[model samples]
Target: MVARDYGQYDGITQALELVGERWALLIVRDLLVGPRRYGELAAGLPRIPSNILAARLKELQAAGVIRRAPRSRIVLYELTPYGRELEPVVLAFGAWGFKALGDPRAEQIITPDSMTISLRTAFRPQVAAELPATAYGARFGGDDLLIRVQGPELAVTRGDGPADLAFASGPGIHRLISGELTPEAAIDAGVVEVLDGPRILLTRFATTFHLAA
Candidate 1:
């Protein structure tokens, strides 16, 4: 049960009472990427107050949304099956929120987990199904992600390696994802830089993963 309960016994109200608190769903978002130690969670959500993180975690655990487990001699917080079911909700919410995203604020930093979920949200599995297998090393600010696309499968993991294309971009990548800029235009405007590999793959990258703005 949530720490607070509304007078009404509605389902949506109950759901909100459980995981609707500030920072709670974001915690679930990172956990969707994978399990993480408490410190790792804090590092991902840098602005979350320490006490708030602890309290949210405890509340989520109590609500059966998450649980703590020992991993490699360290405690890790991970989602339970019920929590995993929130993946689709997060992806849809992310795509819906993308419409309102303008230029990022100066202090807004993109973490690997945020980028991972965003990529998943924007991925065009049907379009990618027709493209050749491709790998990309993507850099968003100080974060690095290895993206592999084969048919309808898409995987974004932390690291960089041999890829069909490697590109670096900050928040301007959003423009590309939102179709505000084409691949060629993005490169010309210096919104995206080719780090390595053939530049043509950048066009494929844009086609394979995009959200209609």
Candidate 2:
């Protein structure tokens, strides 16, 4: 742990002392989806130094926020139940931050975890309720994700499986969700392709979730 102490009294200060370190909450963000090996975490957080990543992992482990277990001869880091309690906190942060997001800089990149988390944070239950149950398979940045919407519930998982619709671009997905680009526009631009399933599902998928403009 870093040497700075925020004091033992206030809960907010204590919480920050545990997770306020740079890149720490982001590490938690990536892990919220599922367990990840060190390399996977490193890949998700492309900019974090290996040593810093190791240090953050150690700190989280010591705080009982995460735990390490052997998986197929490799160790996987996952959140403890106590750590999982921060889901709402992370999602709220994402929702609040969405309004500040402008176009990405040239050096910025999007990862699958980031995409998945955005979907979670921006889900609009009232809008989703109007759509029929559906699933979409999305492939972007060489990653496959399964997006499912059932009534008012929406979920995004990392994997490619049976889906009612499929798409293959990250920015296209982002644009669709943020209402920056319509589905038809994305298709016309050839930024997104429907590899399988009905085109209407793609339309519904685009309309089901939204972010604040």
Candidate 3:
């Protein structure tokens, strides 16, 4: 018989042990988006070695953070409900750490509101007649901006801060987009400030928002 070393740790220690590795968090991040096959996970993470990812997946499954789903004959790894609980934690930590590190991943983040707003700002005329003039809320750098079309449908950019909005409130767009604030909570807490028009107008415009396909 062959033996393998399975080190021991207390409850908290074990939790940390599972999540504390450099690449481990990215694994969780990928699964948070949706369940992925082994190859898909490997493809998404270019830096990690296949063997290392395999080990981490096994560890997470063993710890009950993930589970193996049999699709066809091959097994796919997906986060367990318990594992899914870590989404907010992971996203918060990623947001905070990315800010500190000034990583490129920070630039890629866009909130649903921001995404719609940016589309309006960048490509509004394409769908201007289709969009209504509403006080759409946005967040960036932890500050929320209530975007209102006071004049004509105007083009917007990142630099156009402190502009007139129907109303504005809440945390910055950056956090809200990052799952730091759900759309409902943003309104309930009055953190989402508004300006010129009704917030529902913002919701309406958001329907036309698009992202990089």
Candidate 4:
């Protein structure tokens, strides 16, 4: 925690003091995906100043929000159980913020971690519950994600695979998710390019993952 104190004896204030600094929550967000080396964290948050990153890491470690551990003989930063409790809060926050998310700014870029969270926030398990099992290969910029839907279960992992539908898209995929465009419209408008897969599966993909504007 930082030296600055809010002097409030409340849960929200205390929580903010622990992880309220700029770039602090983003660190936690990435860790929510998995443990990461110092270099990997820095790479994921390329805009964070090195000094600030180091300071936030130390503070989070001191606050019991995160800890350094050896993984495969290499040290990595991961969230503690207490920190993991913020997952639901983070998901809610993302979903709420997404409602106001407009078009992407020129400089805005999507990292794999951010994309993973986006998909999670947009996924509608209820709709997927009645759908057949399907897998989608999604690529945004250079990041690739394998999204699997089995009944109401959804998993998004990084890497390639023999997916039932493989498609490449940019920020415009948000249109499909927001219901602004149907699957066929997205394809015709070139918002999403079918890389390899049955075109019909794209409709299933739309049915599986979506978020209302």
Candidate 5:
């Protein structure tokens, strides 16, 4: 068993300390999907300074939230089971805070726009059959995003894609598709934006995926 270092406040205090920093939760978010090299984490989280990123990783390691995996004599970060246990915590906080506070910016340091959510939740069809083999860039918000897609797994930066279609509806896409938010509402409120792509294509793309609705 991983020993608990905290005596009075016990393990909870240690865990909170590790994740209480400005950028720590995002580190966990990125790592939750899979193990990541330092550079990959840095690329996804541009706001975190190099030194702080290194420190937060170290802190998580010390607190038993994350561990390093051996890779070609280098190390990549992966969450320990204890770390994975925090997913509910993160999600719960997001749910409650977003509802109660009107705007949940406290933990949401970054407002993930439509493009980010679209890629995250959509069905990634085979790119080899759709677009050219040449690598292309996907820009969400102000930054060029990264995802990786393994044979059956879809990741953003490292994933192989020249996706023939792109959807940029942000959070409303998730809501509309899930039936939590209506498509008409999203369109009328301008909460969703479709850029440089076919609306029918997006409609077809959205319907193809079974997203809990």
Candidate 6:
């Protein structure tokens, strides 16, 4: 059971009662990208205690926000259709919080999932429309992601795949997205390495994402 009861008469209170638990919404955020095995969820949220993660999963599953499906021999945890409906809410929250973002501490880490979500929150479709369709492979630590921008839509998928451009480093990309560092600055500082793909694509990528002013 959840730790607190908020009376639950008003709709706002009811919703908060259902999702206000710490880490609950974060689980939803991670699953927003796609289904994940327990280990994958844990890896994406490295700081969450194992017991807490299990408990949150159980709570979300009980609330009909998530479901378990057997994939081959392993079970994957995925958001239900109802849970997927939270996309707008999550994205809105991310956008609202973008202005509050500041420099990271030395101990803080950026996970691949968070980076992908940031892209979703900060992507500029108007700017994207000015660029050609391109796929980017991003390597963050040991994780690999495929980021495809076609027309005005952007899709981010985990795992490696063929791409027109490829780059590595999480924080550097974050800096570029947040407009804290320009693409040329990041490259000059040797923070973002272009493993392959056209050099101009990097400039387009930098232009295609910007945090709210």
TM-score of each: 0.97, 0.88, 0.46, 0.94, 0.56, 0.89
Ranked candidates, highest lDDT first? 1, 4, 2, 6, 5, 3
lDDT (C-alpha, whole model) for all candidates? 0.92, 0.85, 0.55, 0.89, 0.57, 0.84
Best candidate according to TM-score:
1
Q: Point out the higher-scoring one by lDDT: 2 or 6.
A: 2
- Mind giving the per-residue lDDT tens digits that candidate 5 earns over 10-105? 666766566877688878877766788998889778778999898888888987899999989888899999999986676555444433323223
lDDT (10s digit) by residue, model 4, range 82-198: 999988888888888878878878788888898888788888899898888888999999989999888889888899887999999988788888888999999999989999988
Q: Tell me how candidate 5 scores on lDDT.
A: 0.57
lDDT for predicted candidate 6 compared with the true structure: 0.84
TM-score order, best first, reads: 1, 4, 6, 2, 5, 3
For model 1, the superposed segments whose C-alpha errors exceed 4 Å read none
- RMSD to the hidden true structure, all candidates: 1.0, 2.2, 13.7, 1.4, 7.2, 2.0
Task: Give the per-residue lDDT digits (tens) of candidate 2, residues 1-213.
Answer: 643496577888888888889989999999998899999999999999999999999999988899998888899999999999999999999988877777667677778998888888878888888877888899887889999999898788888988989878755456677778788887877768888987777678777777765
Q: What lDDT, from 0 to 1, does candidate 3 have?
A: 0.55
Would you list the clashing residue pairs of candidate 4? none
Q: What's the count of clashing pairs in each model shown? A: 0, 0, 19, 0, 13, 0
The prediction achieving the highest lDDT against the true structure is: 1
**Model 4, residue 101: what's the lDDT?**
78
Q: Which digits, one per residue and each the tens of the lDDT, describe model 6 over residues 1-213?
A: 554687668877766766778898889999998889999999889899999999989988887889999989999999999899889999889888877767666777778788788889888888888788989999987889899999899999888899998998755466777767778788877778899988678888888878854
Model 3, stretches more than 4 Å misplaced? 1-12, 103-213
**Displacement of the residue 183 alpha carbon in candidate 3, Å:** 22
Instruction: Score residue 65 of candidate 4 by CA lDDT.
Output: 95
Comparing 1 with 3 on TM-score, the higher-scoring candidate is 1
lDDT of 5 at 95: 43
How much is the lDDT of residue 190 in candidate 5? 62
Native RMSD of candidate 4 (Å): 1.4
